[model samples]
Target: MDSRLAQHLLRRLRHQAGADAIDRATGAGLLTERRFRVAGRGVRTFVPGPLAAGRSEAEIARILERHAFAGSIARDDLPGDNDPAAVPEQSAGHDRSKSLDANGLLRAVRRSAEPLGAADVAAMLLLARSITMNTMPLGEILEALRLPAPIMTITGRVAGFEKTFLDLLEQGLVLPGKVASGEGHILSRDYDIRFSHVSDARWRVVVFAGTELDPEERERTARQVSLAAQSRYPILGVSEDEDRLPAVLRQAAGINLVSGPLDLGIIRDTMRAVLGQVPEGDIPHDHASALTLADLALAIRSGTSAKRALAVLDDLARIRMALAAENENDDGAASGKDSGRKETGSKTGKNSGRGNPGSGSERIEPAVPTGTETDRFIPRVETLSGYGKAGDWALDLKEDLALWRAGSLHWEDMSTKLLLSGPPGTGKTTFAKALCNTLRVPLIATSVATWLEPGYLGDVLIRMSATFAEAEAAKPAILFVDEIDGINTRGSAGEWTTYWDQIVNRLLELLDGSARSDGVVIIGATNNPDRIDKALLRSGRLERHIVIPKPDTEALVGILRHHLKGDLDAVIATAPERETGRTDTATADSTEADTASIATGEPAAAAPRRNEPAE
Candidate 1:
């Protein structure tokens, strides 16, 4: 999985994809092949370790895909000439604005065979991908797709204001207006869509009228959105004693204005009022360019700076509940409903602030889309308890956990950093899960063993980074790094010492509070805590330690009853007889019987008791 080997394999894939130049160069040994003699077959160079013995193209492709996912074989390594359609132009280091033209973009989107929507226009225009634009660059191939905020604009003078028609014509909406000498000079090209100003003022307007919209409704909705914009912004209204304009325009979210010339100050201010200075998130593909230009124009006009406004909205129910409680305390319970009016406006169009009102566009959260695999990271049933033993230690955890969840104090007050160390299978991992359950957060677990799977230093480092990134993205969660002992730097005195040093450094950086932004708590679990780097276990890191001992005689009986689901009263009652010996794991017979003897005595009793004083 080294860079050179990954490149070689990628070249092979490109060659198989019918890249004549790559095939010729590969045959010429420009991309030399290294051979690994595995299982009586000389597996060619660039083959993933698991598939080193694989001789089939399909197997090699699968391994190559895995490497691509692991961030080793980059997207640039793939050939684009063979089938540019199959290999999307958007990839590593590829800027869409350079390669993307409207024709190819429209063709790619239409190939998806999905009913398109309002939201798709912005994605199409920019050639950008997002959570909504899933499997993209490939295109969105879905059914029953719906999008909010259909774009439209209008003018004051109904038929005379030909300036509005130019926007449509340039967008490929209308053909060149037919007129004589007084008509506008027409600029036509076979390119899919382009935007510019037309010179002719008295030109005939003919909308291209594509099948994207239904015949009847298409022209009608277009007219509505178009004429309204013109009517609102009278070109000759300002400075000259022309038509009088409204003194103020109400600001509504989600209403994006097309960027261009603002002839009058009122028109400029009106556009700013609706669209705001921030410009919000992605515009529909068809309109992203126009909207971007529009934002730049507004930014230049307005002296005010813009800030992103996508913070958490207050819950209406919570506000009502608090209001209701206060009214009841003041002896106004019977008449509270008449005077207590709560306004929970939509996040997109309507605002709690008062202004001129009309029907507003509905808004939805654009990023981290719902119904995706990564949406809900938390994993626990409502009934999540009994993982911890019945004692002051467990009670203390519960007490702080409640305060932490209720936002009563800074999360750091509840031990943001903690270490859970114990013998294998002694509920170390279980405690990690239980901790998340106690806090009602998601559990994102990764291990040093899993990171080493790629069998390359850089590949493992990439995996580690990706895992941490996942935990970071899912907020208010717990990150559990299991088998952390694999990262031990104690006995490393070889060529790999420098390699291990990098990994330990990266791990420390992530857990050092330098990388975390969310309410994320990290828990590191290991059987041999003594083997871990002392730097990692120091204060401001995993400084708080909890040692989980082997399930004792009493705990073992409880475990048996829970698992059996049958009559375990007999087992619990007679469990005291087995006090002569108990295993760390239920099947501790796998370990030396001496551990059973030692665990049955003072060590088992002392570990649980020591945890109490630490708490």
Candidate 2:
């Protein structure tokens, strides 16, 4: 029994002599009130007796009251005075031969212009799409699809663009995203005559949200947006910058114009406009309006094209009839389903017991591949010396790589493995690659975090060993480990042991250079060496520690001399051409030497903060 029916029956039973006690405690979540009893065949207040309780005025009144209050659909919305089996009559203006009843028979052979269900939603979306698609019965679009009943859920998702724009401002970029579940199927069903639904076709709705866009970046983004939109779903570019957005999006795929805080207001107005009602200063709750085709066209058509605008007014009458037919289909489907549910104990169709699509049994994302894909080797480069000759940095690195590549008979004396540590942009990774370039060897780069992506501890250790094996395959090569401090045990205490301790131990065994390939050189680069485990930093694995510092005045001058050769004359000299503009190399080199004395062999790129403003 329905909750209201149960409530009414309980209230009536409460007035009965013996049922007073049960009624006193009835105001909780208890669904039903029952008592062991045997009432007569015509009893109206008991279960399994409604079938025999015919012609009783009290029972009939109670059933009618329940339908009026507790129905899924409001009783007033149902057709034919709430009669389940009643066939509706045709409109006065409907054509005699154009009968659209369930069997193509006359709904009564008379017709008059009626209203459409989708007209409201169509108008709302048209308002969202804003200016262009007026006077086209655009609001009645869904009613045109597969005899569609317009029941679209329109949500003006301002959060998507607001968060997107602000995030881009933070990153110094406002990128666009794709629109997954809008447009096509909806448009197809709603405006089937003008546009057929293309379910598989999806285009991106890229947002361009910044105050200004770089010419090159803008060009690139525009090209990507167009190509993607043309081939797939039309891009609905949501723009926030008022001045720049209109011009930039004039030729773009699709655009929605909205101001930051006023976006919600714009959507509300558009929905009201589509629903054929005057937008109130506040949202309106009265869902009834009498906007005819002429009224909507007058509202939508922005220009003096009254002749063309009135031409489409005739179509609205047909639209109203079509909408009514589709609505009858909707009502029938709902009633049929309700009847089925009432008769059978089990659910049927659509959401029947196959289980909810969005349940918790989703699969975990696949782990990163620890095989050949990660083993890609970096090519050899010229020299790190040009990057910074703080201590003839390039020459010393080249010599080390050359000796190792030559497979020196006394290779152990060379101490193949080294650790490079310094502040960012100190040329650690660059110098490591330069070392490989000079040796004419391959550079295999991997990080500890990549190995740990497999989740479990045992898997990470195996991944770590596999990386070393791949590096050994390209023996006499530099294995550059970027961000090696990720496995540091500095903060790993009693509880964190389950993580860092295992990784640090496995890394120690892999560092034994002599036991495996003699040519395998492990060069770990990090900004913080203090965080690494002391045992792994012992005299064998990562035997040498190199510190890369910012360039000093002299080193900066040298690095500048090497790069800004011709550019310097342009910068400093205002005088006319000098064919023999030879610069003094020795003076510039000594100028660098005099300023700072760094650990001469630790080859890091120069990062001098000579002109950087103090923080």
Candidate 3:
């Protein structure tokens, strides 16, 4: 072994026992011979194998214990055997020292307070060090250091203050207050500190001992403590006074004040404790008016920036502009026609056709045809009739309409593939027609009974796709499909799924496409949304899931008033009286007489039968 190699082997043996070191040495082929001697306590012995040497005296002693090589080897002894595996044990003490230095534990204590009790200072020091080294934010550090046991113990020990220091912790200024427990004993006193911001650089520390203390004494103490801490640990602190505090502590650690009026000084100190100062720059000031309800609603829906939301409101305003223009045009045309009639010396009637003067005298136009196939279709005004429960149904429809207009609850987008489900004769179909009429848009009302055909699956898909395409081309129109669930229900296997899936897919595609296109809506009315497939309810696709709930009392009353045109007070009063047979004959006779007069178009000659009741 080389002499230097032997020394390295000995240094490696300090952390390992004899057998382990020999195993390592043998594995490395460093040991060729097997002979060694041991001499300690006036005893001499000889063993086998190679001897180990160390770089230092301590390592040499460890190596002797490992191989029982108690006898000393001289520098004259040539290299015996060297193992590649034999490596020195690195210093554990140095690594531990590095960790403590990195944590800045010692520096934190010296900066806190002199004559500070070891335990209290230790707790604060650990907390501050953890915050500084670990990059813990100020809030967390304050919480860890606010533990009552450590704080009170340290304060009592350092300031000779009593346990009443716990009371100081209760004041919200220092920390948040604690709730009292049973028998007037505090269950817990935990302080919560909120950090506004943390500085990027180390802060300068300023300790105020007292005004009476000479300035020289304060400076000496501060410098001595600061230097000692920085030398021992990774952190550094400096002392400062109020006038010089902000500039010195601009971005430094916390300061401890010993003798000033705490509240005012602390507030001013905190105000100066900003992360950094903002640079002066040009600032713009622009003011705008508050939005109206309609504008506000559009703003929320678009979720655009304030300026863009305002732009959307501007677009909606154009709708009102167009309406005003149309009104003005109508007025001008009426005036022009009236002037022409006076010039031509012909009397004008309301029915005068634009080109033909006497066309109205030839024949009367038929009442707007309902349920008839015509090229130019106009919606017929249907008289809504009510049955036992149907009268209350219309009210629900009105409530939903109100909700839609108010935007309290918005309707599905005009392009949404909606499913309006309810029991039959609940006005699902009528409501659909009414919406189309009210909006004055073309309604392509198709029924499942009419659309389904006995044909190939391809034919069905083609027809379904064509329907959506045509609806899209006819922009500003509603493709009102009634009983939609009929064509898309479960249990019809094979071609049914294929056909229905294609239909749903086509509907979703059209809905998505039309959402970007102007003025097309698809209103699908069904009696069973549950029976409809689940894929249609996804967002941005038939996104609105409106459950047309049954009518409540208020809604029912509105429906009755709108359609019946009957005396509500009389109906309500007479309802119970007639049911109980307590209605007087005079009132009953007058009601029957009025009904007969309405029905027959004749004056009533006699009173009604006493037994009969008015409906």
Candidate 4:
């Protein structure tokens, strides 16, 4: 290692283990060193010595376990005797010294709008931190920071730049991530990285937490960690979130390098990185302050038009403002402290609340009506028609719910999330309402478009999250997400890519079984199931896809009877006795056509009461 790299590693070691730890290691000769008299024999500066002459690899490896160092030392940099019993070194995948075209990099930078964005700067911070304070291999960290060619093409077009941003990242940062599976996926979860290395003499385990894992998965992860502790290779604990790991693993984590909240500079740089430039006008400081890196990633996309990016950002800013206000309101409510602002409907719209999709003008309507509304004619799953398999699914859910409520069945065993797909007016919304009645739970009705009504990306996200929160808050509830296909699939490279990407990702997080939505059954209705992001339908989410096909003739007849409250059945039974005159063929044809319209999901006219005779 060069002096600069050695000094860098030393500072990182000091940060991770403390000054005394490094001093103790040096005194023990674990860190290779050479003594030279700078001024005189008495005044000497101890510089990093040639590894070939200093400590053996085993001694260096012992310090790794003793201090619980998270950063890896390049094996080639260490000098070790050909002792077969010594600990094995992990192979650094590729050569870092390979020549990269500085001219090509400079050319890309000059063509780019700005040097970097919040993501790149954050990547730099993450890279530095991972090197200095964590157990992650430097190669792995660089792999995570690497961007795709398209992003490089956009971000590299910097207006004016002199030097390479980071010498360490010069080769790999512009390239795409090569290993995006396993550990790479974990590293890519968030911009802020906080991980620690736990080790014995033989094995190393990098423990971190954040993402939710079920009991079985947790057991599997714990077993993996234990196995890694018995082996030479280091294994990463399955997570990127905090307070979600098993207690045994959590206790063993030694040192972490956590990231702080983003600032205007990072946010601007992120925009520059993704969009090639920041939009004109000042970003709302409050919104910018409240933003997470995920939110920023969701707001910006590579190859996005500057106009769309600006719009998305503006929307995000407003959403943050509204969310901050809403949070304040919630806090006030909790503390019995009154905020002068009386609770109106939502900041985004009038029809926002738990299970309340609002009257007439709202994008979504309440599936299960309340009180007197429930007394009015509304189909229950038992009486509903035309749903076919979806109805059977609902009945099964009702049974499972009964068993669940009786504490005879586990929530994990129940199929909670479902995707209902059919053409418009196939009574998809009605199924949700009927299911709500069948399950006897409140229905929180929402849609992707409804979430966007606030006209800000941030507000839409807040609303989306709020809807899920509302559903979760009301356990034994059904969250009816209508027009779910409106949440565009993540495959599009269009103007609204970031918008849809954020929405889809947020929905995935909410719909995830780990998000504490056990009793909140999610029924996503879409006219176009193919338009949905496939991730949404993955296991543990809306995994079951049931089609609510257009009603058949028999199903239409059942639907008609439902609307008529059995009055139509009475008419059919008594028709043989009363219809002595010849039936009009045209009139009969018209009646059948209207019935087909109802089957096609056309709104049906109000029927006479069961007590009242048909007109």
Candidate 5:
């Protein structure tokens, strides 16, 4: 056998034995190193015969196997049972009467005073057993323990191997190893055993119990162990367990598992948990009746646009009447049930007559028998203007508005349609409304979504015709279709062959009819003008294209002041010089023209126009 292996086995055997007892058993007869010259040429070293014959190899192997450290020792190399002792003086006090005599060895180990507890012994055995099977890696150990990988290293003083061993020594279970140069020789260390029959099963059970714990709790314990280990061993604490979470928390406690049907009782209980108790008399009981004709009249005079205002009033009235009827039915049902008798016709008549003054004798007519008079009071044509960014653009758009207002831009004779294309939110819709307001005519606003209703192809044409008829009746009206590109965009062949072609054809026909001698302007607003149908932009249709761009700094400042009520001084301070120059030049020209016109005693015929695009 290799000398190193022999030495390691000898150390392990000594650990199993009691080193002090071994020394006492041998007394001063124990071996000492001796060097002697051989043939006057070489020197040789040897241990004396008495110490060498202290224990047979078989006895050593048996002791190691009993302690579960057999891997470091081998049993087959022992001398046969029949063979006589090689050194008889070492076996002088041998007791052949006992099956195994470890008294000397035990005494020696006890003298060394190396102590190990049940838990430590178990852990060591488990490590040894696993290593014997070539599975010493911590990953496999954690798998056996059924733990999620630690997020951090296990550490601490109380739970680690070195601390546990130190604790054993303090408890008189271990004695200090050999010391040299003021440091203990770790290789000479050995554990003292108090019991001879330590069962592997008992040790395994203890280890299993220690390892079985909640994952988070296990991680905490591991960290404590690592801290303990670091005090003695130069170990880099790295997690070795896998990080995967378990699919089912089979051992989890304190959570309710619901796997059955839920009914109204469960729902009520859940609501109670979430919303708490309902108070008495919290339920709604009173409600206002529908708006009468008098109420509608009052609302119409309240500055709300008459038609829209009436529509709102009518809707509210209908809802109130429906609710009142439902309440009446509920009351009747409760009264009938309380009476506890079949309701006769005479009794019902009497009850109904008492409940309602004119019941059964007269009809309850709605407040308005006909909406015609209400319609007359409401303006058939109405317009709103001067709002948002579009209103600012409309100030510049006044010339176009004037032509329609003067009846010079008749719908039937005109060939060009109006294209108001601009960036979104810059008030395209507002400009369209302003134009209608300036013309003193109602707007017929339509967009692609409104026109493209399912199964409404024919209805679209009819609606278009009706709109034109309304505009002609109410002449000088603006027909504004916001997001015009949505309806008239270029598309793939399939779309062009199907929905697009039909929609475009209808729109073109409507544009042609509307852009005629009778004053009606077909104003189409789009962010993407390039997507509009070419035919619609042809002369005598929507030929006039007005592009609205971002406002200049002066215009922007003016818009900001209008929208946000900010201090103009701060804006003026930060205003670019180029914009100031333009403003100055315009003001100078206006002043010169004003002076000239005043000297001549006639007002200026024309105002100076801005070169910037309207936005």
Candidate 6:
């Protein structure tokens, strides 16, 4: 049995068999569990299990049939493989023995008779996970489906996703604000089950989208999301920029249903659903558009005939793609021309130090040198020492990053932001760079000192905001903010009360600023934790505080080894000789001094030998 065939069998069984029958088969040794390891963790998947071990395809089919899983089971449906043990079980049940209603999950999304395209099915699957995880109430999904022209607006809010919406809109395949009907359209729905106690059974669901909103509007939306969550509503968020949404909104959103590219079939169905008919002539099925069903409805409502809209959209798509290709060509040529200089500069540390942070809206990569002379010699956190818990934390972060990149972990779930407190020589700043190298992400370093270089309160605040904004732009990057204690305590500001309060307040906002700091692993280094604003150290700001200790002798040795690099082997080989020499010198000198003191009828003198200094 192949993995694919095993998956196919599981899929068919879910449709044909009852939960009890499947459970019985599994319990009766007909099925065995296979474990899949991901990021040092094992995930159990139940497939044909032991039944496929020694049986032929026909025999397995018969076994399934006996279990009342299927009728008229065909041998052709079951794939043949000589090695039965080779196929791992498909991922189905976890630790739980019972099956969650797969059919019910299907019906929850497929509210209409129309077939679901890839994007639709993907959306449904994400929504189902949200419901099952108890993050979102299923009733909310139902209600969202009932709404007419739910807004799935196109905008450039998040970095990577901005291009997606922009590209589609420029091609006319996506229309902005079409489904909104002058009101917000949150995907998933709420159903008014007349006096059924349906909504009361679980939690209330609230859905909202602010992808197209301006900064001020998004703030208001964030406030609304926060209020809704405070009111005990389980929010299901639908946005293209899920990561960039306000921390409050993101925290509230149990299920984030991001809109993906729409296939031609879905587009056709949407056109028919909105306009009563699809456009005449062949519609391209090649590329998926970012357009949603609401976009189609809006386009229809905008007075353009379905046929004419389709023609115009297709034409614009061709032109957009052509322009995109041209732009790519230009970018590639420019990159090639600059690659040598950039690489050389990185190696030589010529373009190092705090990079130009005020450089327009373009992504500014902070050029903090990561405690190394050149890029090649920068040691990872694993190679460092004296960081105490911070070192262990960095290792854990490294592992989590691996899991995150592998899609087994989510960003919000990762303990990425932390405050590092230690005296000046404790390598707090160094730990940040080491963590960055260990995680293999870019480093964006800024400090309270740098923020004040511009003098004026307004300019300082702008610099502070820009640093955070830069970090967000270079997502999955390490943002190291040094001298965080410089953002003085609120009440202690005294005469500069207004200035320092504003600065601290701004720092707090940037630390948890949703879209601006999302995806950034923030490391705030401070020499004095007491001086830091209490609110800054509270949960959701820099929640975790790790005090980096001064490197002990062993740590110092390790640091030496790391810096020594090629010289480490030679140093290690001669270490015993040096230790032996020092020991012999101390013993001989102590004996001579004691003998001299005894002969002179005086008390033995304290002899400082080897590495010790004479007092």
TM-score for all models, in order of appearance: 0.33, 0.30, 0.27, 0.38, 0.29, 0.37
lDDT of each: 0.38, 0.40, 0.36, 0.50, 0.39, 0.50
In model 6, the runs with Cα more than 4 Å from the true position are 1-377, 515-518, 567-584, 587-615
Which stretch of 10 consecutive residues in model 1 shows the poorest summed lDDT?
Answer: 234-243
- What overall lDDT, based on C-alpha atoms, would model 5 receive against the true structure? 0.39
lDDT of 3 by residue, 265-308 (tens): 11111112211111111111000111122332443231234344
- What digit string (tens of lDDT, one per residue) describes model 4 on residues 495-568? 87877776777677667633344677888888889988889888888899999888986677667756765354
> lDDT tens digits, residues 1-615, model 6?
112322332233233223334444445554544678999898865655443455433344334544333323233444345434323244522222322233432232122212212222222322222232221234764464344322121212112334333322232222221111112222212522121123223222343434544444556666555454443333434444443345565443333333223334334444443345666543342222423333333344324566876775566556555765686566567666757422223210002212122412222233455555554446677667678889888888888888888899887887888999988888886777677768767777877888887665544654565565455545677878888888888878779888788787767656666323346788889989888888987877788998877776557656655676665446545543324445488777766664444333344577886888888
Ordered from best to worst TM-score, the candidate numbers read 4, 6, 1, 2, 5, 3
lDDT of 5 by residue, 286-345 (tens): 111123223323333322443444355446556766876797677667667878654434
Q: With candidate 2 superimposed using the best TM-score fit, by how many Å does residue 525's alpha carbon deviate from the native?
A: 1.1
User: Worst ten-residue run, lDDT, model 5?
Assistant: 356-365
Name the better of 3 and 6 by TM-score.
6
98 in model 2: Cα distance from truth in Å? Answer: 99
lDDT of 2 by residue, 54-136 (tens): 21223222332333222122334323324432222344243323322221111111111022222232222322332111111
